[model samples]
Target: MTFSIVARSADGRLHGVAVASKFLAAGALVPAAEAEVGAVATQAHVNLAYRSQGLALLRTGVAPADVVAGLTAADPGRDERQLGVVGSTGDGATWTGSFCHPWAGGQAGDGWAAQGNILVGPQVIDAMRDAWLDGSELPFPQRLLTALRAGDRAGGDRRGRQSAGLLVVRRRGGYAGTGDELVDLRVDDHPDPVTELGRLLDTHTMLFGKPDPATLYDLTGPLADEVAALLAAAGHPVGVAGLDGALASWAGVENLEERIVAGRLDPIVLEHLRRTAPPGRTGD
Candidate 1:
């Protein structure tokens, strides 16, 4: 009915899960994670208790296998459950109940566990693992989504796709300069939810992402000359305007590093601005 990947990031500061299912909005039932703790996915006769209980156990230093055992032991319907877990140390574990639907089984490895039940044979899970291993260079959420896409391509959800979800978190928001959740996006129900999820993530990044340190603009020359050119080029028409205008101009078309790397703006232009822009406050 569903396939999911639970993983701990290489830097050990993130934990997340990506899942898609034909079981209505799978996001509401599957995929749970806590920053710096671990992640869990429960499906195929899912025991909802596993969500909070699994996080609690991981928070208390419990191992992935132990968490699985504890959750299963408390569930009367354990024989119909399919579950996967990845602990903070990258330890991975999975379980497929003996009484789960057709084509029910799973595979587990060092950093991830892939599982699904009903239809599509074991290739669904296999393709998910293979995609993750192949996409190792991508970010954790991207890697997880890549795996989900692979399973979907390999004939996912013995039933069909109805909902998809992605959850990720780190010590800090990793942007917006806060100690809050980093990534919290979900597609509760949609004919093409994965695509929608990606769109939302992109929008979130544009608004919340802070400029990378390597991209931060630093100056080394006269502020007057630099401000003058920036104002002229921006069609500000009005020279230097004010402190707000100067700072806003500083964060111009190419002043942000991510934009430069993304080819959305010219890197040389950003570099020049960094070397000459003035110091001041700015806001949206």
Candidate 2:
């Protein structure tokens, strides 16, 4: 019926779950997480309590395996349920009930867990793990989605795809540094929900992502002149302080000021300006 991955980032600053199912609105029910606690995916029998209950247990400093044990023990329908959890420290655990459909089992290792039911062969689950292992270079949400795509390529939901959901939590990673719901994207129903989810993620990135220090562009000398000129052409003030102020305002509107240094610039922001400004505009 579904396949999913739950993981904590290698740096332990992020945790998330990506799930796709033949059912509609799978994301709303199958994935759950907290900023510094952990993440869990409960499917098969689909225990709704596992979402809040698991987080509560994780918040109490319990291990993921124990959390699974406690949750399952309290539910009489445990035999039909599937559960996966990843702790804040990157420890992971999974449980597949005996009554779950064929090809229904899971694997848990280190910082991630993969589980599915009523679908392809064991290879689907394996492909997800392999994808997660191979995606160290990607951001945590992207990596989780990559793993979901791998499972899909391996024949994800036997019944077919209808909906998919991704939920990621990071410290102060929400809109405007408010909460921790970093990326809560969902394709409630679609012909190809995975690809649709990707599209949404791209839009979210441009609006919310911060530039990495490894890719920063310090504004000084001739580069500053070029940027100032570009700003002016874009109808922003061209003075030194005014340019920075305008860029800051732009960044604020986009919710992308995290990568900005008050006095410097980020190359990614410049690239954004170049690409999104106008047809006749060009800047290096």
Candidate 3:
């Protein structure tokens, strides 16, 4: 009993999946993706093979449709399976077996494929597709979960909500992480899985995420009022407040660049300071 959104980024450089279900730790079972390959979701008599094989196909230059074809060809029980795939090219597809269960079905579109089984009705898939097209229009993880939330609102996983998970990959680090596996957050078990998933994603994006390096700076000379004003304008009060502390804490340090790099302040805050201050006030 689950609902899932498998998608590739509009620009075709990223791939991700978000899934929620009445099952325990849905994230552990439902989603898989790689930055250079694509994404896959296997649910409703879920087969783990789809995870490795599907990605291998996409990595080997197979299209989404062909990946499904090849996968189904090898799995005689394909008709009883609910699956979704997105290729590196952004091609998407879904399959819902006629014998799946009541209220079971799915939809495929431009860059995403949404599907669910043992739900309230086709509305599950319908709401997912609509939300994907009409939601916040943010990046992949946000958009994908928005679609999943829509399905949850429509009555997801006939068994009820227990867990949710999100996976995203890109060529470079996302708002968090040091590599292409941008977001791999999951709510293994929750009474309100969708809400929990959203909360987790929001928190993950804001706090633990890596800040832009270009915003790092050096604070030389006396603190400038213009610097505070600039930092305020650019949305960083931390840097403005911490300039004196950074200099004082790091005995005799004049440049913000060295202070920031030496762990005197938050990198993101330092980066903001570098950007907002006038030229040469800090390294950009």
Give TM-scores for every candidate, taking all chains together and pairing residue i with residue i: 0.77, 0.88, 0.76
lDDT of each: 0.75, 0.88, 0.76
Between prediction 1 and prediction 2, the one with superior TM-score is: 2
Highest TM-score scorer: 2
For residue 272, model 3's alpha carbon misses the true position, in angstroms, by 14
RMSD of 1: 6.6
TM-score of 3: 0.76
Instruction: Between candidates 1 and 3, name the one with more favorable lDDT.
Output: 3
Per-residue lDDT for 6-117 in model 3, tens only?
9888778888999998889989998999886889999988989999999999899898888888888899888889899998775598887767877788788777899888
Q: Compose the digit string of candidate 1's lDDT tens values, residues 11-122.
A: 7788888888887778888988888888899998888889899999999999898988999988889999999988888568999999999898888888678888885888
Q: Which ranking of candidates, highest TM-score first?
A: 2, 1, 3
Better of 1 and 2 by lDDT: 2
Pairs with backbone N, CA or C atoms under 3 Å apart (clashes), candidate 1: none
lDDT for each residue of candidate 2 in 216-238, tens digit (9 for 90 to 100): 77787887777766665566646
Where in model 3 is the C-alpha error above 4 Å?
A: 174-177, 210-284
